[model samples]
Target: MTTVPQPLTLRAWRGRRVLALLCAVAFLDFVDASITNVALPHIMSDLGFSVQSLQWVPSAYLLTYGGFMLLGGRLADLLGRRDVLLAGTVLLGLSSLAGGLATNTGLFVAARLVQGLGAALMLPAALSTLTTSFTTSKDRHSALGVWAAVAGLASAVGILLGGVLTEGLGWRWVMFVNPIACVLVIPAVLALLPRDLPAARTARFDLLGSVVVTGGTLLLVYALIKAPDQGWGATRTWLELAGAAVLLGSFVLIERSARDPILPLNIFRVPGLAAANLTGLIGFAGMLSMFYFLTLYMQTVLGYSAIAAGAAYLPLTVGVGIGAGIGAKLLTKVGSRAVICTGALVAAAGLFLLSQVPVDGGYLGHILPGLLLVAFGVGPVFVGVTSAANAGVGPSRAGLAAAILNSSQQIGGALGLAIFSAVGAARTHHLLATGGSASIATTSGLGYALGAGAAVTVAAALVALATVNTREGESPMNKPERVLIVGRSPSVLVDAVDILRADGYTANATNQFDRVLDDYDVTDLDVLVFGGMVPADIKEQLRAKVDALNPQVTFVQGLGGIAGLIAAQVRAATSQETQDGVSYDEEKREVRLTLDTPATVTVEAWWGTSFTPPEPKSASMRVFDGQLDAGSHAVPLPEEVPAVASFVAVTVDSATQVFTVGAMPTAVTQLAPASANDNRLPEVGQVTT
Candidate 1:
């Protein structure tokens, strides 16, 4: 027999510890990406680099990070996730150290490239670990919330920290800080994570496909990065774009024929996968453009220092945290489609507000409110998109799913920055040529660019509304049945909850009955189950309180073990039958009747109907029992009876009753008595004479 694994409870110490570690790793990735932005000027001056060459410091990282992500994800699946994660962490730390100590531009750029590679390997592995470790939907949702919160806030935090570190300890410290932090993180990752399962030796590595895809992605990203500097219509830009297209097209052809493709083409067939990725792409594009334009506006137009400008983003970070929390809760209540659409619209509204900022605008009047709105709006979108992308994916493909999402964000950010920057620069140049001041021209350009970003965000919202599935991860067998299980042992509680959930019920188990009573509204529950270990008095008190609140709620008692409890709950839930003088034998395919005197009986079978209320119409069958001397009678059902028939109802004299077999319900009504000769099969859909 196969056994289901129990999910970790959010309240447990181990669960909290794992979530903290995962969030910390995610935080490091974002912080490292943005921290260097503030230190760019210092690095250029210290390394004696030209302005044009200095751009490579950030660009090199983006290239390697975006290019290698899919391959890294494939490695995680072919090898072990733990192995890939540890290797990446160590590499990230060493690269940070090398970057800090570099004496020349060449070495600095090389270190940045290595850092990007390390991040590519680390991110997807870490996400896969989190998704697999948190088995229950509730815990996974909470874990992803923390992950999303860290992702949303870390960029802002990085800017602030970079400014403080660069000013106090010099630019080198900005590079050195990540390695120092990794000293603490490396040991925790090793100690906290479980041992990896053996690698899948049978899985073939698709080296050719990997090379083709990586080259294609790198060329595409390079084109986008250089498009603003080089005229978009320039020959070099067009050639590179055309080359990227050819390479990507070849990758598709190669994957279709590869024995084991790095990215299986079939993964896209998963419901909502493509839609979610598209939403992420467009959404991230708008968000990244907003950050880039706003940062420039604060420093160049408003004359704010790096530290002051970074500090201004604190409100946005807090708003994102709030939105993540709300979105996580709403995922269970309303599903991903509604939450994502709502979030995208909110973000668009925020961007529209920011587009109206003037050169002389204060932080309070123009920046803060707009930042808050954008942060909150994007927060829910991140959560919804992440959930939609990963839903229903198997463990083997978990890393691939994470990698795709990360790549979407990275590529979207790069592309959005390129496109919006060009638009803003062109407008700025036009105004400058017409004799406008630098400040007015820059402000006007940025406003127009932001308006374009807002339009893109609105488009993302429409895409989400139209394509994201409403009932993600839901199974037909699992209706939304809310159940509460009270127990004394944690092990037993976890087991019972898993079993009930597997059977399609929404189950919550708690060892602390008192705490549960205080925390949850038990009256809203459909079923209440008491484990054998639960104290009788405590169970009675809780049950009495719940019954008073909702008298219709079913209560199951006297269950001894996890299996027993699950069985009892299922039986109680399906046992809604009202029988008088008739009974149906499911296995024997027969109906029996008991009578006190000579009386006519009518039997009917209702097929293909739901047991739940608001039942639909079903095909019915009727049989007549001629007036007969009393005691017991057996009526064998015809073999032609539909296999989908769910209930058999018998009417005796003037009485009627309803009963259900499996998921179908049956109802019987009083009928006139008929002679035994009337036992012939009635025409389909015709009333018996």
Candidate 2:
């Protein structure tokens, strides 16, 4: 098996700029999510909002961000990725401008809500672009490593920039910053990245399915967010949670009947996928809560100013960047399970250590060490899980898998923060009720949250240990090469796809040969097969087009009707290097073959100046080994062959019948096996000694 992928050379992929643009967008997302928190108080005061209502500023963004995320990913796949990405970017930029300039709570909150929807659209498109842009694992690993580091750094920088903007340029600048960056990004995108291919002509949006899924996810996120304050046992909370479950169940039913489901029910079947998503959820739950409680402790108990608290995280940010670098390096060397478990243990230790913070603890003595540990563990977990989550899903659904994993992390963060905060608050309340000092109670509560987060990280490590395999954890060859089958009937093509996929090829099919270029990408294409039912003229046109487009693409003429025969033709086209059972008869104008192995082999006969085409006449076929299992078999050519045409069958060079080494035959002829007395042997071992 091919293990290592070719290096992602920028000159070839033109990916350096693409990676930069995607990273910029991701950074904006992380920064915007964190930046608003620092300025929440300012907005609350200015808009005359109460404490409960103030939560909406952040919740509004999270609500739609998580709610519309899956839909956005499906849209990226169905619609052109560039189109969705641009739409999202424009919406986000406009929303940011609106939020920055708003004078009242309603307008600001509305802007924030739109921002979430925009993010829902933007993030998946960006991630899918990143996923599809680099086809090789080494390239992907290198790219994701960079992206992982950027994400870690961006979250930290967001807090730092949040404080700077809130203190220096006023809180509105925090909202304004996105638009300024957008101004630079819009043109950069147009100039840097090529426009995405046009959307498939037959693609459907699954509107009803989208509505059900969006509603389910939104309700789910809302319930999780409010459960802490609403009380988990509250009738309202239970009703909301139950409603979400019902809608999700409804989504499953809807998908079974939908012509094209937005999120395919079958994607969950990908190996290691469930565990990867679970790891993401558990990992984010711990790390995000750690950030939250640490910030709270700094601002409330340690009596640090907002800026000072933000600046204090600098070392943690550096540590995470360093850790991410380390993780990327280790992922290939020691494998994902080892790295994930090790990182988690180190992080858990840090969180546990931080849990012992004294009421009067300082940053250096108490906080920095824990932050370093969390950073160390978090980097590898995110990097490893990101790869693990996406393994073997194929390019068609890359966006969906990316969206799902991201959604899990977002929900995990929200849920973890809620659970930990609620527990800590209750503990603090209980301590104060018992007459504990205010500082001690606050410190103790923060410590409790951190400790819980540590426990969660440990759980994430366990999942990785259980589910991750050496290949997924160690190398970048996560997805197989893709095949595109063009035929006359959709059903026939779909059946072919199933067979090819079952046998380990990442395959897709389309009935319209004219739309092959639009329906699927040729970048990662391994084989392009024209079905027997497709028009000769259409095949000629498309084959010529593909030939000019990607000369390395193996072209096979599907000279057979059945799905199994078509799949066999594809198999032969891809595995010719080891095959040696075919030859062509010039006078007979036919293909001849012998089968020693009981396997289906597809063969191509070329006739021209050379045995390979660019020849004048050629024939392709699938030969079933069962029909000729007892002995050598001969395959006759099509009757329509011109009497004058020559033929050449091809296979790799292989040794013919064996003969005695001591004597060379002056003339060779086929004959019955030699009589027992005629067998050659070395006389007395031909001993020299």
Candidate 3:
């Protein structure tokens, strides 16, 4: 007999604290990645390094961090996540100690590479641990939510914490602090993580795949780094770029044929994964560059203290947390596609706002708007992307999906920073050659950098718009009962199924859209409401399909947006026949008139209260009323029309007639006979804004 797997017991499952520990570990990993930024000045001064060499500090770290991400992700799967986590933590501590106590530039750069490797390992392993621990869909989603929140906020918090540590205790502490954090968390992690063994799968390591991908990543990063120093056309730059192309091409080919792929080609077929990954790449590319440029601006140009700069970024961090929380709450209701696309577009808008920041711009006007917009844009994106990537993933492969997503962010950020820095530096050089002031050139360069970032974000928007395929704002099961009526409020139609289910109409109400199509035998679907539907091609197609399948089905065009129809009513009430109502402002010498008709009409102004109507009026209004004037004769209304200070409302009434005038003050078109009956006007209801 096969032994049944033991189910989780309540007391033995310390999953909650294990999750918390992983989050903290991920936070520490990112902290070391960016912490040196705030301490760059002190480092440069202590080492007596040139600006050129100083730049390498960031570049070297970014290069290795991005280059090794895929490899690290693969390692997480091959080795047990628990073992990788412990090893990574030890590597982090040792690297921190070495980096903090470095005496020479060579020693320092070597230590940074070590730190990047440690971070690369810790990040994927931490993510794998969190993802693998959750078994059920609901639990997995919840776990991802917390995981994404921590991941999103880590960079911002890293800088802030780095700033405080660097300021209070000196630059060495920035590097030293993580080891302390790691030591504090490791024991708790050891206790809380489950002791379950990893499955002994026969998957082999993809060394060829790793080498090609890593080589490509390194070459791409090398091209970026070199482009800033060497001209873009430089032989070294072209060689590196060409090498990157070849390596990446090879990587793709190998992955397809590999028995055990490092990067699975099949995950791209998942509905949400491809879209989410695409958007995440674009977002990280644009956003990470902004941080690099902004950091330079704040410290080098604005001369902000390290601590002060960190404090200034707090608003953005807080906004991101709040935005993510709000997005998480709304995802179940709004659906994934709408939220992700919207988030990408919103992020592009934020980048646009940020690009407008001038050399002398104020923080309140230029920076704050951009910061808030970026925060709001990024928040939903984090949650939506995380959810989408892992939406249908099995427990065994969830870690792989998470790794791909994480790698996208890391690689995108690295590439974005490198490209934008080159742009900024190039622009600065161009301005300086023209004899511009150093400060002016610096700011102008920042503008170009940010502009490039905005452009990449726009590309991201296009990706999101094109590739994100999930339906927006749909309930899971739309129809649950048979013989249902649809000629009611859309919400009411939705509610009917729920009510009927409670009343035992059928097998319970459903919100799944596809189930509605399948179970009802489209021919048997008794009713449909047209007016409640949005004027969308998808809805139209669905309607056509149902109509074609079941021609006998009844359809009811339940009126929707009645208030808009009434607003159309108010617009139609302003046309005049012969004598047009006009208001004049003597001080401004302006006169305007409104006319009544559904047809487009134009109004002519002659700087007088009364003037002959032009054959073709420049402006016109619409009126949905009982009737329009019978002929071309102007009929004045007794009621005082709602008039703007310089405009007057006009009304005409008859059984039914419409008249148009031309530029020569002659009638353009007129109905020969009026309709026999008038449409009665309904009583006005309260208007909603």
- Best candidate, lDDT: 1
The C-alpha stretches of model 1 lying farther than 4 A from their native spots are: 1-6, 198-201, 467-473, 479-689
Order by TM-score, highest first? 2, 1, 3
Candidate scoring better on TM-score of 1 and 3 = 1
- Give the per-residue lDDT of model 1 (tens digit) for 230-262: 989999999999999999999998877765678
lDDT of 3 at 252: 88
Q: Find the number of clashing residue pairs for candidate 2.
A: 0
lDDT tens per residue, model 3, 247-294: 999998998887666776755755557777877888789876777787
lDDT, candidate 2, 278-384, per-residue tens: 88888788877776688778888888776887898898788788888888777667766677778778888889888889888998888888888888877777667
TM-score of the candidate numbered 3?
Answer: 0.65
Clashes of each: 0, 0, 28
Q: How many clashes would you count in candidate 3? A: 28
TM-score of each: 0.70, 0.74, 0.65
- Compared with the true structure, all predictions reach lDDT values of 0.73, 0.69, 0.59
